[model samples]
Target: MKKKYVLLFLIVFMLQHGFSQQMVLKKGTILDALPVQDSIPDTFSLYLPTDFTTEKKWPLLLIFDLEGKEKQALSMFVQAAEDEGYVLAAPRVLDSISLSNSIVKAGKVLSKVVGMLPIHRERIYTAGASSGARFANLVPVFIKDVKGVVSIGSSIANTELLNVKRPFHFIGITNKNDFNFTEILAAKKVLDRFRFPNQVLLHEEQTEWPNIGYLKKSLQLFTLAAMAKGFAVRDSSYIEKALREDIIKVNRLKNAQKLLLAERYLGEMMSIYGAHKNLDSLRQIQKNIRKDQRYRTMRRAENAALFKESLLKEDYQYYIEEDVITHNFNNLGWWNYQKSEIDKFISGNNIYEKEMGNRLLGYINALTEDNIDIVKSEALIDEDALALLYMLKTILEPQNFDFYLETISLSSKNEDFGTALFYLEEALKNGFKDSDKLYGLEGTALLRITPKFNALVEKYLKDARYEIIEE
Candidate 1:
């Protein structure tokens, strides 16, 4: 029989230690050097379990690491493979090709080697850290049947490379004091934005011999790998319940932690949504208000009172309202502040603002800080004051609203319909759509009230020419 079809029901092997232990690795070319070209040979490796020789071909786990020789990461894979019942492979990408070319060439070779062994070609999996993680992410797209990927200390920027949506679990492990913290954080943000179901594992917090983090990392890899291969380490509901409990335990704040937590949470909300007047859902309103010290101590009895006040109040003056929305020189100041903040938090730039104006500008621009200057400047309404005046006039006279409507309509037409609709709605609601000369403006205003009006009339002059002329 060919090696793959050979039904060896029971197989065993001896290790260098010479003990005839209960075998998991089948005697195969698990570790071997392969000749890629005539002269250049590349070393590849794998671990096939003894149980793999049973009735069915077993699945395989692929590990890509720096030179694929990191013993700790490899050991974790070994234990996990045996525990979960699968073959494990770790390929030395650097030994074969450069970092950039290693992805395709190494993946093809790995798939070829796995094919010769008694492995379920359909259940191949991959995991890696840093450059290794990058390769694992690339393989599933090119390597035919890679079912899942575990990305550690790396991020997927070009998401098109990820062909299989089976299951991707990203675990970020970075030393808190590592100089690469910013780069790692940027990678984490990219992963988050991609909506990958992931967990940001901070390794610095786990301080023990060999570190508690290694255990956490290994478990994450194992759980996700098992999930991809259609196996259950524990009951699904039990796993979810455990994860939820852990979130609660970790996220709960202690004494004096509430203030910082509130600041961070509100700041985040403001950053995301900006100065939107209508915040969605009661849950969001409550979440925002609960961050404040005043509302933090609120009881069930005070719910109604707190709820009403919080929704109407703009007491939050931190990073959200000030920095993102009310800055002067949204002209230049806002852009500069955003760049600086991004440089500070995301890029690790540590420049101190030497000029007081710039520092004051940052504060006034901050959603968390006082924005009195921005408020004052907005009140002044300097040069473009005529537009506001005309807008007010249009509001008072619905009939004569033609001029304002025409301007906004033209502006919207140049852009997209959404922008046009926004301006149109704002003009109407804020009384800027009225025309004193046109008595039927009120009736016309009522006709265009719904959002459906924008879609219906975006190409109105062309398609609905008769309708416009009739109006």
Candidate 2:
């Protein structure tokens, strides 16, 4: 009987070993993407570290792109993940997929990756950008064992859905120009109310992706959170190193006279490390800093600015819906006036108004982008509504000549000559200098021959009133 039991134990061990061998992947390369499941078009990409082997389990980050740019998103984190020793996976969840379906696909990815790679189930995380970022941050609500998320260029999708029972660390990345900038602050407040572990990295809002340094910062946040919460065994050396670097950063910002930035970073460190490490020294620094008159004024002003942002967001949203539904093209002038007012506030000396103005601009543009998306893909198609939105969009984003041309095309096609003529004048008044393009607009057969159209030609192009530019 003893001999038989020994043989059975040996057989079981071999079987388990065989399974693990099959799961091992080539190190230091992004493996070809695989389907998440049988029928779903959902697929995922992966990158394993050069030293990664089935011998040891690694922490995992399941990243995603809402538009199915999975490999690109995965690549973005490759350097940071490699440096921090994380196994990264990213799902190519298409934008066309419903959010619930995307969530289901993500679950499949987690299950498959956990099985194939020796992933530490307890250390699983998620990440993405924009709408994908919102979805990544939203996943912990449905799934379990998501320890953290790196959400870039977005805020929490819906605060009502947050669960305090299963708290996850959230790291938000955005720039001042990102439409989600103010929304992130608002979302941070909600996270604070629930006492969730969170940090935000605000970068320069520019045309390019944030520098690799930002990704490294995110990795540090993840590492610190994991250690602080005891999800991973504590690494005192790493913690000490991070704290020291952060201190240097705080002092650097203060010396640069970026007082608000310095104060914000100090607050983040206190929130993250207050209980985990000795913070008396940090507290003293913070207390002395808070007593400064400029710091207090800036903090108070920011709160007032946030309140103003919320109120203006309400106004922009109400007008967007009302104007779209009512086809109130007349309100374009009012919208233009609002934009000019925001501009004045932006260029003004008062810090509070300037901040509010910048935030409001981002907020309105985000709303306009959403409205444009709905008009393109929603169940109900409304051309008139789209045209009215274009008219308002031209005013809200006057620098965009696309809205002007779209407005003109839509109005002329719908036989609304009066509205078409009014916007033509408005576009010129707004300093649209492209006179050649103005006379060359296509698809205006019925209305382009009118005197108002000819007037535009004569006033701007220096062309004869009777002469029409043909496409």
Candidate 3:
């Protein structure tokens, strides 16, 4: 009986060893397309810190890339995850899939990771940018154990779905030029009403990922929150280091005469460190800054800009709807004139107006894209509406060659060669020199070979793919 038991133990050991060998993941590297489960078709990309080991539980940041760039998304957080000693995982969820299905897949990936890794149940968080950020904000709603979210370039996906009892730490990072900037500020008010712990970080770029330093700061905020709540042990050195860094930033902002930004940072610092340490001094500084005449004036200007932006956005919404429904090609000139007015605001000396102008530009483009998607997704497509939107897109973003090409293709599809040829020449005038793409544009076989098309291509690009044979 002893001999038989020894043999059974040996067999069990071998089976366990074989299973481990099948997934020999390396730390400090990103592993792509790892299956969530043997039976499930979904896969996830993962990154383990260089010091990662099964000896202790580590925080896990589940990242989402709605465009399906899992590895790319993982790379953005890898440096911060490594420095912060956190595990990063990005599932293959995409915007192309239904939100419900994406949530199910993300839940499965989270479950699989928790089962396989030493993930701290209380330290799990979600993060993403833009649409992905919006999706990440929804993860805590559907999936339990999500302690926080690091949402970049967006706000909550649906405020109505939020449960106050299950509040998570929300860290939002956005820029003035991002169309979602004002929306995020408004969402902060909602979060405040729900009594949810939240912070909004502003960066100085258009709609894109925040600096990697901001990424690190976001994870640091999560760590601080964990310590404050007793979810993790307090590290005096870490907390002091973060506090010093923030104070230095505040001083720098103050020195630069950016009182509004300085006050905002000071307020954020007070919230973050208030539980960990005394913040009376920081609170006083914020109070003083707010009382300053220049700061108060700046605040008023910002509020005025916000109010004007809302009215302008409403006007844009109404005009766009009316134009799209009427297929009002006559309103194109009006749209062009509005672009000029926006340009004036952008170039004006008023910083608030400049920021508002950038936001409006981004908002209009997003609005146009949304309408285009809506029209295309309908059971019966409206080619005329699409063509108009595409033309408007070109006007809004003149350097964007894709919309010009799209307009040309749609016109060609409808056998509107005059419109097609007109856009083709316009595209060339706007420095679109892709003769190959023009030649290969869908529904433009005959259009591309036309004398006008070749002449325009030859005029701008100095080369035409096809020669029109004169009869």
Candidate 4:
């Protein structure tokens, strides 16, 4: 009887271990979105993590990166998901267009795929790198019921599209010597403007390409870190050994060359911002880095944007050298750059800000005006403020002509022709580079003006009473 009891206990143990109670989506089948009998497309590849099963309703995380055998990365995410009782269903965001566009299409495909699985619709999430980050950022915009997102190795912007009330966690992983540090700083500034919580982890170890297993490790921890915040997982079982080793190699283990790399990165950041000039925030950063005496530098002008950039960049570099030291990389040093811009805008003292606003509004007004008999409604733009938007839009962002034209068209449809013509004239007067577009818009607006420009043209050809305006 004792032997029988032992055998039963062993059988149950084996079952429990084999059928991991961990929550992960395992078993991925190629879910073709094309019609039945259609050939398989290269754009659609689905990966299921290890814990997927048909019996239980699982939460899902859709990864939207390019096709690389991220088998290890996917495995770590799966382990974390399983530990947190969630499923990971990463679809290769079809490469046909931008990640945002692909995400829109993926939303439909996601619904179809999840419908066939035992997935609960309430807790969907997304994460990606590079182009994938853009798609992951947009997933919540196009898909409903997503709880959060995790972005690795890149950043997400256009926060307006996101469910603002929902939590957004961003993690960026880059090397200490990365040339895009300035670009990364700029992106951080933009995110600060939008008030999103983000962290940048700069890898300090210099193993070169072949020796840099630490880079992968840092990325995995970043994934885990985001998973912890977004999904609320807290257990070692979620992080496999491979992940832990990688994290230790890059973060815990540091060498002299890596330390030098960290210093150079910090110096570059400090030089850009002249943070040593700021008293309070820079002082606080100094207090934190007291041990690293060499980081001290002379202060420069009162440029908070430059200062914040310098501080974050330098601190990130420090963290890279000494993984043991951790700092709030999310803090943009409590500087109010946006407020300063707003103040200048309010005071009408900042020329660039004034112009940008005027150009935008002017373009809006111009696009909205139509014929005298059918006046389109006034646009949301404040006429006085929009002059600057128009000035900047026409001069600085010439690439926006098409978009400006579209906005004008929509405004005209909803409102009048006169206003649209005014914007066209403003754009033209302010060095609008695209003459072809200007002529087309001008012609369209004139066609709908009072007294009928087309009719007048015909009458003028016969009676010579009206003269056409030529540019």
Best by lDDT: 3
Distance from true location, Cα of 251 in model 4, Å: 7.4
Summing lDDT over every window of 10 consecutive residues in candidate 1, give the lowest-scoring window.
Answer: 350-359
Q: Point out the higher-scoring one by lDDT: 2 or 3.
A: 3
Task: Write model 4 residue lDDT over 250-311, tens digit each, in one string.
Answer: 33322332333343333333322231133344334334443453323211211333454356
Better candidate number, 2 or 4, judged by lDDT: 2
Q: Per-candidate TM vs. native?
A: 0.40, 0.83, 0.93, 0.39
Q: Tens-digit lDDT track for model 2 on 1-471?
A: 222112111011112323422332555667667655444566688887766667787899988787768898888888888778898898777878788987888888888788656788778889888777888987888898788888898889898988898888888888765557777888999998898889988675453357777887788888777776676778888888888988998999788866777877888888777657988888888888888897888888877877777788789889888988787868878888899999998899986688678778877877887888888787877988888777767767777888888888777878888877877877777777775576577767766677778777578656633665565
Candidate 4 lDDT score at position 437: 47
The TM-score between candidate 4 and the true structure equals: 0.39
Model 3 C-alpha lDDT per residue in residues 23-118, reported as the tens digit of each score: 556677788998876556899998888777677999999999989797998899988997898999999997888989999999988987887788
As a TM-score, model 3 comes out at 0.93
Question: Quick one: ranking by TM-score, best first?
Answer: 3, 2, 1, 4
Instruction: Give the worst 10-residue stretch by lDDT in candidate 3.
Output: 4-13
Give candidate 2's error at residue 435 in angstroms: 12
Candidate 3 RMSD to the real structure: 6.0
Candidate 3: what lDDT? 0.88
lDDT of 1: 0.45
Query: Quick one: RMSD of model 1?
Result: 23.1
